[model samples]
Target: MRVSRGVPSVRFVTALATVWGRAWGGSVSFDDEFGLFVCSGMRGGFARGGTTVGGVFLTRRPPTRALLRHESVHADQWARYGIGFAVRYLWEELRNPGSRNRFEIEAGLADGGYRAERGITRPDEP
Candidate 1:
């Protein structure tokens, strides 16, 4: 959808996500570089390594730089699509599981900790 900044719906969704992260009892802090509210130390209630909702990234522990970089792209996606992004993302996931998902590919599969197929390998791998 590529919504512009200052959109009320986007802001509302972002704020809601932030509150959701807080309700999980995670420590929240803003990362100015990626424009994300990093919420770590969550006990449970998320998927995979973590999940980004609007401007918030929720995880069990501090994320690596590469993982943050990958998740930053998801923050941008939420900004672009607003609340609708969730439905779109779920559809994509249903259609293309794991690293095959276009959104994950856009965010960098290796950075998100998904093994790449078709002979592609992460730079850190031997």
Candidate 2:
């Protein structure tokens, strides 16, 4: 997944994640426990979870099944789009901030633990 000398390099991100994760008291593992790279000790920035530059998932705490599922959706997105994923995501967010963004909507508000702030609801909810 490493692209040599490119705008978006997976290897670059992976390498950075190793150091970054360790700095935050986390580590990177090969197992796709959360369907992608999971960093255990990330803080600030992404309160819930975020896909890093190299498609790594950094969470403030251990992710629950629901949170993992939500982040997995984003992982799939990154996989499908590769480096362009962030651009597309940013574009969508810029066009429509908050839960209204289709990506976030697709990820599920509750699944990503954004139900309250984003005002998201499941189809089953009233």
Candidate 3:
């Protein structure tokens, strides 16, 4: 899975997890720091989970299922790469900026999943 610059959702979450590792468990909650993130990516956000290997931040607001997938993939991303994986993740994305290979890219794809209300894009790519 790769870091997403756009929003995330649940559909993408599942895919990203597949690339990194099987998800043992996951959930959503509110946070003053980033609003939303996977347990693994919670590292260093205003959120309480603290900096994990993934440690991602949504900064603006919480997203929908698409956002969930976006963040969840990050969870698996850390699981696959370790705390230092962020740099590598960036490197990979930079090296290959294509959705065909990246989780976030897949997340935003037409087959990707998204919420109905966000208006960020069409709901449920699949």
What would the per-residue lDDT of candidate 3 be over residues 29-73, giving only the tens digit for each residue? 333333244333222233322222343333223344555545555
| TM-score against truth, every candidate | 0.85, 0.68, 0.40
**TM-score attained by model 1:** 0.85
- In candidate 3, position 35 carries an lDDT of 29
The number of the candidate with the highest TM-score is 1
Which candidate gets the maximum lDDT versus the true structure? 1
Q: Please report the TM-score between candidate 3 and the true structure.
A: 0.40
Q: After superposition, how far is residue 28 of candidate 1 from its true place, in Å?
A: 0.6
In model 1, where is the ten-residue run with the lowest total lDDT?
1-10
| Reference-based lDDT, each prediction | 0.78, 0.63, 0.40
Model 1 regions more than 4 Å off: 1-6, 119-126
lDDT of 1 at 49: 92
lDDT score, candidate 3, position 66: 51
Could you list the CA RMSD of all candidates, in the order they appear? 4.3, 5.2, 12.3
Could you arrange the candidates by lDDT from highest to lowest? 1, 2, 3
Candidate 2 has a TM-score of 0.68
lDDT of 3 at 44: 26
